[model samples]
Target: MEKIFYYFLIDVPRAMTIWAVLMVLAAAATVGLIMRPRHSGTGTADLAAEPGGPGPDGATPVGAEPALRAEEQRRRALASRALELHRYAEEVTVAAERSAVTAQRRRDEWLTAQEEAESAWQAYEAADVAARRVAAAAVLPEPRTPRTPAEYADRERYLHRAAMAACTRKELSVLQLSDALAHRNGWDPRRHPVEQEIVLRRTVRDSLFAAHRAATERERAAWRDAEVAAEAARSLREEAFAATAKAEEFRRWLPSSPSAGSTDGTAGGANGRVRPAVRWRAARAG
Candidate 1:
């Protein structure tokens, strides 16, 4: 019984050791078989087993060339798209610059025109003032009796005819009066007819002089009226042009931005003077 017990302890342990070793060997062999590269017509296992090496069939992996080509095409497409975007961006930037320059030039032209118009307006005003001064210096003539519109309409013709008649009649009357005065001076104290003829000729001459003075005054008044009317018309025309130019300047120079309205007066002129809209008053003046 003692020998049997000793044998069971030693031999059993030794046998168990040998079995464990064999099991380990079998597991290692199974792992090697499972992990080993298998030669195939497709050669997928060779490529999987050996990195950066030839396949078992000695040909490159299937579909690898197509994948590389596809990748190349993708890279080229990306590059092309990037180039197109760059060109588009550059074109947009150039266009924006050109637009800005055009807008600036337009603004300058408009501003110059406005200044010129303003100067013209001032000159017209000065002319009008001078005309008014001249008008005031002359006394406007009035007629002894108010004439009809038709008679006044042909006033120049009437004045010419009337002055001619007055001069001719006065010359005849003076010649007769000179003869009567010479004859009267010879025998005036004895005869009453000589004195009466002298008094009548003197009264006729005074009447002729009064008529001439009235016609001359009327002519001067007509000239003054014409000058005043002409000056007023010129002033109105200049004022209208100035207002219209100012309006056009604002429309052209203002920027196309959200803040453009606020920047109008501030950014418009050298002196920051804002141009007002063309009011109806300008049209009325015209």
Candidate 2:
């Protein structure tokens, strides 16, 4: 009985210790697996495992990290391209809108210039006609004769007064009257004032014609500038549209990127700065 008791105490304890040690070893192994560190960049330890041994399928873990890294790099490149194209689209759109606005403003200015030119020509024509009528009266002789240059001044002044009496208050400006009467086309001291008026009529007619020519030239230049500006705006609009489409395509190809066409909250947050679809429509319209 004592031997039996000794066997149970010693032998049983020894057997329990052996089983406990085995269980402890298994638990320690499990803890080590749970606590293993992984690379932060790749979020994996496949490279570390490759040197130690092959996987359960009898293949090294070498193929995992490289393919994953390559895919990751490709996605990064797509993201960069999409961002760049979005900015380019925005720049081109702004330039196109500005050109359009400028073209409109120039067109309005051209119209105003055209109207002013027409009015100036009409006024000039009327002045010329009036001066010519007065000059044709030269067929009649001067009512008075002057013997000296000093005497001609008073006599010419008196004759000019008679001519002024026939015109309305605003028919001729004071400055215009002075310039017209200042020159003599061909006159003896006794020549009629009507003959001297011929020079005035010709001067007025030439001035009017010059103004009309200038106005015509301005209208032509304005039209040319407007055409150039319109063309530039159209070209930029097309470019912006193409860029926007290209960027959208890149975004679609990205695996993790939000959908540019999606109206969902997640997509909206991700695509906040770059609304490629909206811009594409706007550019097309422009």
Q: For residues 89-189, write the lDDT of model 2, one tens digit per residue.
A: 77787887888898888788788878878887887788678777877776676666557876677657754664354233333445555543563443232
Query: What are the Cα lDDT values of the candidates?
Result: 0.46, 0.63
In model 1, the runs with Cα more than 4 Å from the true position are 1-59, 142-286
What is the number of residue pairs that collide in model 2?
A: 0
lDDT of 1 at 160: 33
- Please provide TM-scores, in order, for all candidate models, with all chains considered together: 0.31, 0.58
RMSD of 2: 17.6
Global lDDT of model 1? 0.46
Which residue segments of model 2 deviate by more than 4 Å? 1-60, 148-151, 155-192, 257-286
lDDT of 2 at 163: 36
